[model samples]
Target: MSNRSIGLDGPLYDYLLEHSLREPEILAELRAETANLPEANMQIAPEQGQFMALLARLMGARRYLEIGTFTGYSALAIALALPEDGTVVTLDKSAQWTTTARRYWERAGVSGRIRLELGEAGNTLQALEAEGETSRFDLAFIDADKTGYPDYFEHCLRLVRAGGLILVDNTLWHGSVADPDDTREDTRAIRAFNDALHHDERIDLSLAPIGDGLTLARRR
Candidate 1:
């Protein structure tokens, strides 16, 4: 067996999806519609969504928080995995994109379980904290602006309960975090975020090489 994660070529990646991915029809439809958008890259991969849903199911997650709701694909994934009493509070600033997301969430019959909050995510997070929401969620997913990751993470640390999971998307930043010369704004932000989390003792961490990159942080 390989000691490191195996590189996935086009053929291999296709094979992996064909053999393992279980993207539901509604999610597939949502993915298809999102693929036409200019910011389609913002959407998480199907496999990544499935993987996250599995995590929620395994954790028996009931209260989930999402910082970004791009087309609501990831939120829908987790919503499906949660029980009838489960709820998802997803935040986003884009009305147009989230409109598409809402339609699909309705089609999937999980709209009632998901509450969409529209506004600046940081401000909303602060409001949640002010509303006595400390350590209240079972899981939190951050996938919004790269620069806002640090602030969002801090909010999640408090919003997510002890021993809960906080998942950060695009932590590897399309592999740019490894390039010493790529000093771009978002790249730098992601790098700094990763570095801080590396030495952070409050949570157990692992950066999985899936999609852009999925960072799993389990609060201690």
Candidate 2:
């Protein structure tokens, strides 16, 4: 796939991170600590975190849901930006990884605002559905397993209220979505998700060329 998006490369990426992203010291430390982790790629960029925070504020979101916690960076970002009464339910099955996430959440003093649910994402989502959680979330972020994106989207759509926002990460699949030669399962799944989203009439969608591609779907 062609990397048509104007992303900062090597030196430029570092330069932007240093000069533009004024990340807090604690957040920076957390990012550094997880830099070598197997799922380090799951951490959202500082710019992306800032954007999500802004969206949360702009939407006046009080009840949020996140499909993946990943060391709690994004959850922390959103919590910090939300109102005092706001709450976030973050899902991830890894207790090992979430140990780090919980540490940071407590350190940030946002532990009360976040609930860490450890289990298969689909099962947790299904449970939420069974609990009659439809239209209860003001905002939802999906960035978990790629193969399950479609399921996540469907559930999140039901969970988020009308006019709420659902943000899907990695829609571009590192440029693989546009590559005809790429037949990997993750890439194919992402392609199918994108195609379905393009025609889906339930939401107003825009596939932004943000970090790894982010799709914003505002429920109608």
Candidate 3:
């Protein structure tokens, strides 16, 4: 049976975001800018951002990778948690979307910390691997196209160090993963990925019912 559970609703999610997330002035501005975007819902909740930041800090992550940078919210969150010398490599295919991301990243004063790679995510990952980046990253977050999730997972597994963490977003696919009737390609892909990871010995995995669901895999 599927292990996914119901996620946050109106009051609780709002309360959590309000209480736990402390957005800096620049980040607030970035959020406002992102609010008008068509894919604004793709932005991670403020609480989720705080969670990622805390995880990065706890793991002492210096080198980070993000497969999808919508408006740079998650990247900024993780960047804020990193030390002075830390850096993040963020990838996205759309120059149009990344324009917004670049602006926010610059506004957050984290442009220096982030290297935005504009192109196909798979090719970028392959290039990074070829550049001797395999097993070098400290943390990786995959939140791009749902259909490319498995590829992203494989590449991230290769790029993240043995003890690194891989955070896969939208693992629940908005409750579709549990409904056998809903066999859309995206849901099927996520289901396959989740099943494969559940039995994989390379990582210690846990699927949390956070916003849309987040799968945390710590490389073993």
Candidate 4:
């Protein structure tokens, strides 16, 4: 056996879910619904959602933030884990996708806890900063456009409290980041972001080999 994380084959993945996944019925239903969408691949894996939810609970997160809310699955995952008084502000440009997300959120009865900000995420973030919202969030998740990741992370660093956590999705870009020959713009952007994060002293970082690769950066 190698001294590293074990790669999950189909059977092993099924077993992992069978033994550990505690996905709620509502979440399962949402996943099923999102599966039929044209951008279904944009949805985060259920297991990844569960992991983020647990992490939120462990950190006692309250004021959560999200950069890209694809169909609201990830946001729902975090919102569901929050206490009644907790809130999540999710930003996305597409009214269509967010409308779908809103439906699921309403159905889950967690709609009241999530605020949707539909606009250019970068500008929205700047507005928040201009309003003197510094270190205001407990956790911020980034799953937006790959090119915007660096900017999103910078804003998240300001919005998240000292010692707060920032979760970046698709850091691996579906394994493209590790492929030297993948010269695609998105791949390059992800690689650049990862490299910068690796050397950044303002946060403590760890790249997890979960759904599409998740990077955890805790502000210092």
In lDDT terms, which candidate is top?
1
Which model, 2 or 4, shows the larger TM-score? Answer: 4
Badly placed stretches (over 4 Å) of model 4 are: none
* lDDT of every model, 2 decimals: 0.95, 0.90, 0.89, 0.94
TM-score of each: 0.99, 0.93, 0.94, 0.97
What's the TM for model 4?
Answer: 0.97
- List all candidate RMSDs to the true structure: 0.7, 2.8, 2.7, 1.0
Query: Residues 1-220, candidate 4, lDDT per residue (tens digit)?
Result: 6899778889999999999999999899989999999899999999999999999999999989999997899999999999999999999999988888999899999999999999999999999899887899999999999999999999999999998999999998888888999999999999999999999999999999998999999999
The TM-score between candidate 2 and the true structure equals 0.93
- What's the candidate order when arranged by decreasing TM-score? 1, 4, 3, 2
List residue ranges in candidate 2 displaced over 4 A.
1-7, 11-15
Worst 10 residues of 1 by lDDT: 1-10
Once superposed on the true structure, which residue ranges of model 3 sit more than 4 Å away at CA?
1-7
Q: Model 3 scores what on Cα lDDT?
A: 0.89
